[model samples]
Target: MFMSRLRRRMGRLAAGVLALAALEGTCTALAQQMPAMPVTVANPVSRKITESIEFTGRFQAWPQVNITSRVTGYLDKSSFVEGSLVKEGDVLFSIDPRPFQAAVDQAAAQVKITQTRIDLTKANLARAEALKKTGNVTDATYQANLQAYQEAAASIDSASAALATAKLDLNYATITAPISGRITRQLVSRGNLVVANSTSPLVSIVAVDPIYFYFDLDEASYLAYQRASKRKMDAGDAEPALKAEIGLSDEKALSHQGTLDYLAPQVDAQTGTVTARAKVANADGFLTSGLFGRIRITIGEPYEALVVPDVAVGQSSQGRYVIVVGADKIANIRPVELGPKFGSFRVIKSGLKPEDQVLINGQMRARPGGEVVPQPTKLDVPETLVPDPN
Candidate 1:
C-alpha cells in the first residue's frame, strides 16, 4: 500500500509540470504573433525658417498737432464737426472777428491820416523850394520844410507797419488745421473766451494714414540685431530693409505689414532699452492712435530648419519629446529642443533630423521599444503657415 501511494503522488507531480511547460510555450508563441500598434507617421518638414522676435507696442499718429488760439477773443463758431477728419489748412474754429476787424479799421484810418499829412508836407516843401529859388523864403525856412517832409514820410512807414500787424491779427481770428488728420473733441467750446497762446489747446489733431508703430528692444535683443547688421555689411551685401508685422490687441495673427524706419541711437538710461519705430499703411483708417499692438520683427536670415506637428510633442519629467519609428518598425522616444511655433507646427531646434519619421497619431499605443505599424503620410504645410518675410 505505501509503494502504490508514492507512485500516484509522483505521477501527479509529473503531470502538473508538463501542463505548466505547455502553457508557457503557448503564451510565448501568442506574444510573438501579436499585431503591432497602428500609428500614423510622417517625416519632419525641411524649410528655410527666419528667426523672429515679438514685442508689445503702440500705434501713434505720424503727425500730432495741438490746435490753440493764436489771438485772444471769444470763440464764435467751429467750422469742423467734433471728432471729424480735417484736411490741411481746413478751418477749425472762428474767434470773434469783430474786434480784429475794428482794430484793422483803426489802423487803416491812421494810414489814411499819415498819407494826407505826407501829401500836404510834399506840397509845402515844393512851394518852399520855389519860393527859395525866387528869393521869397529864407534858406533856414526851406531847410525846416525839408526836415518836416522827411518826418512825415517816416510816420507813414510806421503807420503802414501798424496796418500790416492789424491785418495779421484779423487772419489769426480763424484757427485752421496745420495738418491733415482726425480732430479731437473741441477743448474750448463756442462762446468761451480763449486766451492767445495759452497752455490749454482748443483742439487736438492726429494724422491717420501711414501710422507709426513704436516699440522698445531690450539690451540683449538690440545687441543681437546690431551684430547681425554688422555681419551683413561685412559680407559685402547690401543691408536689406528690416520688415515687421503688426496686429491689434484683439487680432489673432499679424495682419498689418510695415518696415522698420527708425532706431534710437542710444539706449534709454532709465529703461535699459532702445526705442524703435516702423511705418504702417492705414489707408482704410482702421488703426487708431494709442491702440495697443503686437509686433514681430525678423531678426536673422533664413536657414534650414526641422518642423513637426505641434500635436506630436509630448511633455514629461524628461522634458518635451516625440515618438519616432525606427528601421525595425519599433517605436522610440526622442527628446527634442523646441523653438518658436510656426502655425500648427513646432520648430525643433535640436534632437531631430529632416529624414526621421515621427508618429503623428496613436502615440499612446506605441510604447517605447514596442513594435508599431506605421501608416506613411505626407504633411500639409499651407502657404498661410509660412510667416511673413523679413
Candidate 2:
C-alpha cells in the first residue's frame, strides 16, 4: 500500500512540470514579435479634390457645304484647280456657249422681224385714218387697220421678252462658286456633259476653322452631380459650377480653349447615355475634321477623406477590410468603408483611424488576433492625381 501512494505522488509532480514548460514557451514567442515597425504613412488631411470623368469621341467641322452645279452643259473649263482656295463669285466652270449663243441670236432676229412688222402696220393705219377723213375709206376698214396695228405692237413686245430670256440662259452657261471656301476635288472633268439637275454634286466645301467634339456620359454621372450639388445647398456650402478640359490622349492640352456648347435634353434611349458637345476653336486649322480625341472633365471639388495604400487593403465575404495592430500588439481586422479608387490608393470613408499602425506589408498572409511582426516598407505614389486646390 505505501509503494502505491509513492507512485501517485510522482505522477502529479511530472504533470505540473510539463504544464509550466508549455506556458514559458508561449510567453517567449510573443516577446520576440513586439517592436514599432518602420512605416511611411499619410495623414487623412483636408484639401481640394475633383471627380473626373473621361470619354472618347471624334472631331468634326461646325459647317460643311456641298457644291453642285445648277445648270448643265459640257464642262468646258474647271475654273477652280482641284484642291485650291476659291472666293465667292469666282467663275468655277464654263460650258460650250455656241449652242446657247445661237439660241440667243435666233430670238434676237425674231424680235427684229416683229419690230419691222409693227412699223409697217403703223404706217398702214395712218394711211387708213387719212382716207377715212376724206370718206374714201369705210369706218369699218379704218377700225380694222387700227386694231391690226395694236396687235402687231403687242407681238413685238412679246418677241423682245423672249430675246431677253434667251440671253439670260446663255449667261447661265458660265458657272460661279456661291461661297468662299476651300474647294474639294472636281467631280466632273473638262469635256464631261453635266445635266441641269444631275444627281451628283460638282464638289464639296467644308468650313474647318471651328470644330466640334461629340462625347457621351452615363446616367449615373448625371445623378451623382445632382446629388452633390443638392448636398451643398442643404448644408449652406459654397456651390461652384463645374468645368472641363480636353486633349488628345497621345498629345498635350489643345492650345485653343472653348466651352461646353450643349448637352442633349434627354438620355439616349439606345445607349443609356447623355450626349455632350464641346466647341474648340481651330483658326489655325490644326484640328482637322473627323479626328479622334478625349475629354477630361472636372465635375466637382474633393471633400475631406482618409486613404490607405491599395496593397494594404484586403477583401473577403465581409467586404474590404484591413488588419489593425492595436496598442497592445494584438492584430484585429476592422471593416472599412471605401470610396472611389484614386490610382494606387483607396479612399477610406470610415471605420479606420489615422493613428492606426496599419500592417501594410505581409497583409495577404496575416490574420486577426494572431502574432504579427511588422516589416515596414514604402507606400505607393499615385501616378494620376485629382485636381489640387491652392
Query: What's the distance in Å from true for residue 356, model 2?
Result: 9.5
lDDT per residue as tens, model 1, 1-390: 999999999999999999999999999888677789799999998767878888898999978888898899999999988888889999889999999999999999999999998999899999999999889999999999999899999999999999999999999999889999899998877899999999899899999988999999999878877777777778786854577889999888888999877889999999999999989999878899999998888877777778899999999998999999988999999999987787788888899888889999998778788899999999986543555322
Error of model 1, residue 333, in angstroms: 5.6
Q: In terms of lDDT, which candidate is strongest?
A: 1
lDDT on C-alpha atoms for all candidate structures = 0.88, 0.72
Worst 10 residues of 2 by lDDT: 39-48
TM-score of 2: 0.58
Clashing pairs in 2: 49-302
Task: Write candidate 2's Cα lDDT for 26-119 as tens digits.
Answer: 8877656655343333334222345666677887775666766556678788777776666678888888888889989999999999889899
Off by over 4 Å in 2: 1-28, 31-33, 81-91, 96-182, 222-244, 252-258, 262-270, 300-390
